[model samples]
Target: MDKIKIRGLEIWAKHGVFPEENVLGQKFVISADLYTNTRSAGKSDDLTQSIHYGEVCQFMKTFMEEHTYQLIETVAEKLAEELLLVFEHLQGIRLEIAKPWAPVGLPLDTVSVEISRFWHRAYLALGSNLGDKEAYLRQGIQGLQDRKDCRVTAVSSFLRTAPYGGVAQDDFLNACLELDTLLTPEELLDVMHEIEQEAGRERLIHWGPRTLDLDIIFYDDIVYDTPELHIPHIDMQNRDFVLNPLAELCPAYRHPLLKKTVEELKNALTEPEEAHAK
Candidate 1:
């Protein structure tokens, strides 16, 4: 990734815990390292192929002056999100906000808040066995797309498959999707659960039946597990319903743990069944 650095840009803004600081305002310094692909811009010598540092500086200056917050931490967080949203070419940002006029009695030079934020790739599996199965799955996808922090990049054709978990139930409509999001894994899970609730999902039966079931199959090739959620979703390699739809979107995507592509896993799971029928 290439970077466009802007350092020591100063601005006057009202942001502090003390009332006087808000009333009188103070000087603050801002710096940022914008991440993007500058290869095209460099090769063609075209500004349109890259993010404009001057435009970014102006946007940052105006944003800081327009908003009033009690802490520089809030300022940095909000500013980074806005920059990433407004600038289509920007992939990530490392931002620092320095407050030179600290009210502390000490002779410290300054106080600053620095942080890094970026977009993350996540894959999700969608399933529904109850009424209007396809509709429920579509609604779930729409729910994720509706969030500003999440974007649905690709989706697979929904397939009807027999229910798993050894619980006799109707066939389920299953599919997979690729997501580009700024939300953390936990935050994304919360959003999925909210969408499920909106679709009238219930936990009354374990895999017995559901209106909507959204599971996080992968997130940036990272392994994660918790009491409430699991990444790479438990036993996903064994479930064709998951692999089939996922392979449609990303056949070459490898499992972080198993170290096999989706196509490999799908074939490995089905080959034995085919052999038995021979």
Candidate 2:
């Protein structure tokens, strides 16, 4: 990726934990590294083809003046997200917020917070066993694509798969999709649930049957777990119904937890009864 850097740009902002800090604004130094492809601009010698540092500086100036936050950490995070949102071509950003004059009586040049944020690639498994199955799946895909912070990159062919759990109502039409999203894992889950609701999915049983089902199969190289969601989906590797279609789209995708490629998982699927056996 090509580089666009803004180093130590001074600004006056009211940001701190103390009440006085908010009343009396202090000096802040901001720096950012924006990443994007510059090949086109370089080859064509066209300024329009590349990110304009001047414009970015102006935007930063305006943004700083407009917003007030209690912590520099919030400022850094907001700026990183804002930059990525404004610049469609930018892939990632490293942001730093330096406070040279902190209230603490310490002999230090400056105190700063630095963070890096970027877009993530995620694969989602879609299935519907009840109602108009294909309609529900297609609606789910459209909902994901319509989300503000996400883009659906690819969709695989739908296939017939036996019910995952013991309560066999009927086979399901299953497919996989790839997405480029700026949302975190939890945010992605929220969006999935919203899509399911739009599809009128009624959760009567645990994998029993549903109008629509959306599960996160992979999320970049990140591994996350909570009471609500898990990345690299817990049972995806053992199910051919999930691994097969996923492999068709991204054979190189490695499960963060298992550390194995998708193709390997697909090849390792024993038989139809394996899901039940496990």
lDDT of 1 by residue, 147-167 (tens): 988999999999989999999
Each model's lDDT comes to 0.94, 0.87
Clashes of 1: 0
- All candidates' TM-scores? 0.98, 0.81
In candidate 2, what are the lDDT values of residues 91-143, reduced to their tens digit? 89888889999988879999999999998889999999888899999999999
For all predictions, the C-alpha RMSD in Å is: 1.0, 4.2
Instruction: Tell me how far candidate 2 lies from the true structure as C-alpha RMSD in angstroms.
Output: 4.2
